[model samples]
Target: MGSGKRSDYLPEDERGASFAQIPTSFGHELRACLRCRLVKTYDQFRESGCENCPFLDMEKEHDNVVNCTTPNFNGIISVMDPARSWAARWLRIGKFIPGCYTLAVSEELPEEYQNICADNNVLYVPPKRT
Candidate 1:
């Protein structure tokens, strides 16, 4: 229970069922970073988000999945192709899991993907999920 003053001080907009509407579901491929190693889905893990896990920020939620059109890189340029980029680049795009953001490339790519990122200045590296 909370203190009376704290309860009363709670903003009206932040109260009641609106709080309940917030979604909190982990993905199937959810893993925890135990020590330096990445542990696969927890068999009997606690429900709430964990501060200790490195993968906490990387967890993918069901609401985030949408078809992304990714380009094919066959080591060529000057040809136009539209590869998939997540609509919500804020979510780190693909590479995580069901909603992962495993890939972290520089603003510009190296040899193979140079042309594509040249105009856009973004690169996509495939993520490795266990």
Candidate 2:
């Protein structure tokens, strides 16, 4: 039920799927930030990506935005030793265990994923399912 224009429009190629379209079947340990595209996992609840997110500061509506529980990630970066992990330093994640760190796969999802989201009434994705 759109007005033939996207409010989230950002050029043609840059347009991508929203974070809600991402899968949650992976498990509770994983979470993805739609804004920063950071798909890192946690050993427990406290380690999620909610802390000090760049998007949280940018978006004023704290309630409507997604939480730390976000899942079904992409672009994994494995850190064998978090102490010596250069990626962690770059991403500004002060603490990370030895595991795969996935990047958020927001926007421009593959056609197959788009179909999946559409059929399931994906709230975050922009494409209309007709």
Candidate 3:
């Protein structure tokens, strides 16, 4: 078996020890990041923030967490090896940290946060509503 430390499998930039745990079950409190679609409970988001979208600074900021994350997402995907997973590539999350991600987030991020993303050189693509 592999070592217990999940950080060992993550990339250098994403080596935060806290991101090792990914939510595995659907729950009412689960929310998905508007930018990266990483799935986590409300408390988890408040505690650790989004692993892929740290610029949002969701930790302890209830407003940020509420405005940047959506509970209306669809489908859950657990990505272990983003570099080699065709599903991750197809979902455009190949460069994101390995974790449970939503297939589609069904809400829009606030314009303010969108601008923040732009200012940070991060593209904010809204989810398709088809």
Report residue 57 deviation for candidate 2 (angstroms).
23
Identify the runs in model 1 with alpha carbons over 4 angstroms from their true place: 1-89, 92-99, 103-108, 117-130
lDDT score for residue 35 of model 1: 17
Deviation from native of the Cα of residue 7 in model 3, angstroms: 23
Encode model 3's per-residue lDDT on 1-130: one tens digit a residue: 1243322123445436434357744679898888888898988888888877777889867789999998988899999988799999999888777889889977888999988877666667777778
Q: Could you say which candidate leads in TM-score?
A: 3
Error of 1 at 59 (Å): 27
TM-score each candidate. 0.16, 0.29, 0.83
CA RMSD of each candidate after superposition? 19.2, 13.1, 7.3
Report every candidate's CA lDDT: 0.24, 0.39, 0.78
* Model 2 pairs whose backbones collide: 16-107, 16-108, 17-107, 17-108, 37-104, 77-101
Give the winner by lDDT. 3
lDDT of 1 by residue, 1-130 (tens): 2333311112323222111111233445333222111122332123322221212222242211111111211111111111244432332321121222222221222233233322333233333333
The candidate with the higher lDDT, 1 or 3, is: 3
Candidate 1 achieves a global lDDT of 0.24
